[model samples]
Target: MKGDDDASVVVAGVRVGSFTRDSFVDRVLTMARGDSTRVAVGVNAHVCNLARTDARLREALSTSTTYADGQSVVWAARLLGGHLPERLATTDIAEPILRAAAAEGLPVYFLGAAEGVAERAAELLRDRIPGLRLRTHHGYISEGDVSLVLDEIAAHGTRILFVGMGDPAQQYWVENHRDRLPAAVLTCGGLFDWLSGSNRRAPAWMITSGLEWLWRLMIEPRRLARRYIVGNPAFIAAVLRQRRHETPRRTPSGVL
Candidate 1:
């Protein structure tokens, strides 16, 4: 991965890389090359919104390899003079990571999303990347059933685990189970839904203009109105305030 010279601030002790999608992928791939396990967290508007008041959640988010998931974050980074090129949506990242895994013969496990979504996503991935070794466990299982899911992942010898249980839940799962699992996990929210065609993504133009949230609000107005309209702005203000109170820090040039 090419080194980025942009400024980086430490949030909850995690040194987030202020880089574009390609650089972020390179950095993640470099982390994948190491002996120790590494986990990556994709922070979208919802997660960022949650991170504002939840200090423990922020600390957990800081522990993983963090990437900008919402265009708002990309814009904020640019405003902070980092120049992040594009939003790295996990729905998009999933394809590239699966392609890379297929090429490297890595075993991947899909965890989360509604009952058939993960399975359908695995099927879609196989169609996209022939001969890909992938396993999946649906996200609708009860909390009591988590043990069985964990056991299945361990049995499959999963190298990469793509989690799609949404924020806080996905992050909490990864944090609690990271020590027990042998695989490197990536917390991806609703990615399976998008991949399975259960949830449609907004048009590219809307996403580019950071109006994807608006599109989502239009689709699920009652459910998403407070989140996008009210929660997002509050989160942005919190991030800016945090940035103002801190100084940029350098991350070690190696895997987590």
Candidate 2:
């Protein structure tokens, strides 16, 4: 095992890449150039942490390039003997990638989020990325209705698809439909809501310190209090244990 230096690593037969937000977009663009087949891109964090439990998901993640979406994950990586520069929030990553896609003439499709959110997000993205090919599919459809959604994407010639219905669901959707779509899929939880102006992100300082979770808890205390206040602490404890027991792996560049 090599140290982390923005390169890919194979864990449990899956190839996982250590990427910042910028590198993630670049790599996906690279993948899109050769084959517009569906590819999964994860924004790593504790809430969406599948690396510890599910071997397939870990392998899927390893085979895909996972970006450090949350500050907590980046901090944990550093603590667990990996070197990472910063947290690449998915919300921040989406627009820039869309802009790049537009510049390169790559068509993008938005999947997930409530009715109208996807459409609104497309509009917002178009404003930023002029002449960008953007399409949307709402999140309220029935599970059996996925075939219709798949058909729409196939017709659109979508090179990139953003899944914003939150994790596990978004992750599952991408995994289940990767074979049917001709696009690279990135799981972006709640990003559509933020882009559509329905949800406001916390201040930069809070995000930098990994306390954005706290800000979210404050916004919807009754809903998120238990998850962040109690669940996250336990999650942190588990990560600490894993860090202590696992040996640091060096990267191909020899950095640990």
Candidate 3:
């Protein structure tokens, strides 16, 4: 992904790329077919909150392209007077991208998730899209495993590598090894969890109404309680503060 597009929106001080779902998928697949390496990451309230305080995370985000991955982020952009096409949940976009990759006969790699989770997700994908060239590795890798994982990725001739080790860590891993990778990379937080059936997505109605976080909280309250209950308000407050310091700008579409 390239640097912020002309129409990119600053939400809570993080630049979120304005791309329709199709365009983003096309860009990623195009990058996979190219020689040079590029990275794309999804943005949500959790990521925005972290980027506000973590310089390293901010650096990772600044270098890679970003997309709106949460409804809250899309709402925040609208609240701050910017336009994003839609909320592109990483899980939703991954299927289309993989389908395209399958049609093109490009090898795709899934790296992250707990042991056997990525493999399970890969199995589901293989069933979903026949003839998808895919490979997998668990996210729990030791320092010595880095070289092995890279070798496997290279050996598999991966064109796109989806890293799902969660935020900051996944971003940092890509940042640390960007130069060594030969494929287009995307940091996908918890995508494997959903795909592997370890977590369930919200109902379509909840998702469309921007209550997916509530569903997530309902299912995994102990884990996500702080993130949603505490972090969400903090993210909203930060966006409001940012709005106070900046002037709203009219943006056009299709700049990227």
Candidate 4:
């Protein structure tokens, strides 16, 4: 809500914020220092498609500041006559955010990923940005246990919380608890694994070519097959449908 709602385009009924990397980070960092709590959600094709069916996801995006984290979503927006300054991939945004947190002396919390992963990532982040106030909690908790996690984070005085529990669940948690938190939150799904170096990114060439999905599929086919294989096509179809509905057909006169 703190971002440019006018610049956002409705993707499957969810307003996806179109922000450049610097602008997105600036908005979030500024919000973190505000009087009230704010949340930043990374929206991609998979997330947009998920929003169509998941009421929790829809509600989360309705209130959270979202950045375009997928190339597919950028292309889809262009086809629908919407402009995204550029792809603000969540992984690319994370380090800069951490740097800002360190500069502000804001204590940060990492919540998600497998056991030991968050601990490992906190070490890396502390090394990457000296004087960073970092904390870790692996995202293995029942709904009954979330309050304990929240209490611990509050007790630690965390100002920036990164929740990487993936998709709708992460969104749902942040939505339900943002009011209770004293921090700005981001649902950066899978970011802890990547930052910890437990999961390697695709080669730079492949990432630039937008074939990172293929690289991930090659590495974790069993896990990502459905998301990349099925979700991708579904996303494209939804985009095309939205484009047709929102854009006017040109007559032979080349005018509406």
Candidate 5:
């Protein structure tokens, strides 16, 4: 159900896969070849902090092949004494995923994003990744329509599904429908907007410098202020608390 040595690490009881971007794409390609179904997800500081309070989101992650999608989360893992290798940010990785699907001839479904965004993203991907078998549906989907969407994906033989509705909503939809969807599901936050050029990403310097959050905050202050300003600090506090709890070491006498 998971990739080999998936590098799954637990933070505050939520599991996150630590594979490099390349390794993740390879695993998806292999899964597609075998027609395996799984839920692929990602995490950031806000998501981690949310999981601490949101049992539903936490439970959903516990069942997924998750990744640390934010550099800040990776750094927090290190601060908590976890051996996370790097950031697996979704924006940086979506292209490689599409490329893998194109090469392997995997049928992919794009779900979520505003009206027409998913289709636009699909068109962009097909143009860039020749031979990509892509389909799309906008986020106008409602609760009553979930089963219909599942049937559509299954009937079309979708191999990989990307859901970009953001946060717990995206994760919840995939978790609830994955059983009937017949494809590996990826909870890709805002990936469509980035790919469709509806959202502008920061320069490479900002991303590498771990200030991508700042750039996003600058762009959508009203929307993301609480996530970065409040959630980031809370995540740091949780990691430091985890670190403290790990520190009651054995004495040199070899006894507790």
Candidate 6:
């Protein structure tokens, strides 16, 4: 909130902030140390495609500080003649974020994931990050009964809240409750699974070569097949169409 330079790029109609991992963590901590409320969200190809038709999700993203969580999204930013520092996947950067919060003595909350997943993640993080004041609640609560969870969060005096309910649901919850939540709220899809050791990250080579999607597909083929097979192609096509419609800029020489 304090150091937000408002630097961002629009890719396929979704806005993503241009911040390196370091800068991003710093900004979120800054917000956590502040009195004002803010929200952070990460956008991937699946999120972009979903936002194409989900007006509420679009609004949620439009109002939050958005970042590129997908390598494909970073690639699309470049293709659109814009630049994102790099992909800042929440799982990849969770350590630094949590460490910073711990260092700052900020109380943090982890809300989402299966019944025991969040609690396990908090336990591991507490061991890894000493002085980390963290709490958790499973994401299985009924939508209409979120007030109880909100009350628990407020009682903890949380300064940074991470929600891993996934996609539109997480974003929707943040948007609907932003006013009531204090400090910084971030939407972290599947982060709890990775942190709790229920899921593993792709191998370094796959991640570096941007084949992590393939790895994820391999690991959870049935659950993610449509998302990768269909969503990936659709995202490419959408960016291509956006590229085709844009008029190219000209130099003084007027060479075309």
* Reference-based TM-score of each model: 0.86, 0.86, 0.94, 0.92, 0.90, 0.92
For model 1, which pairs clash? none
The clash number for model 3 is 0
lDDT of 5 by residue, 1-256 (tens): 4433434555654566667777778766665665546777788888888888899998787767777788876776666555567898888888898887878778888888898888888888888888988888887787798778878888778888888888888887776666576557788888989988898989999999999999999999999999999988887787778667775221111000
lDDT of each: 0.72, 0.68, 0.87, 0.80, 0.76, 0.84
Which candidate order results from sorting by lDDT in descending order? 3, 6, 4, 5, 1, 2
Q: Quote the positional error of residue 248 for candidate 4 in Å.
A: 7.1
Query: Which stretches of model 6 miss by more than 4 angstroms?
Result: 1-6, 143-145, 247-256
Q: Which residue pairs in candidate 3 collide?
A: none
In candidate 3, residue 59 scores what lDDT?
80
lDDT of 3: 0.87
lDDT of 3 by residue, 170-221 (tens): 9999888887786589999889899888888899999999999899899989
* Per-residue C-alpha lDDT of model 1 across residues 100-185, encoded as one tens digit per residue: 77787778889888777889978988987976999988888787988888899878867788888777887777788777665477
- lDDT tens per residue, model 2, 85-199: 6767778878878888888999888888889988987887788778899999888879789899989988998888887776556666677777887647778878888889888
Residue pairs clashing, model 6: none
Against the true structure, whose TM-score is highest? 3
Q: After superposition, how far is residue 38 of candidate 6 from its true place, in Å?
A: 0.8
Hey, what RMSD does candidate 1 come out at? 3.0
Better of 2 and 4 by lDDT: 4
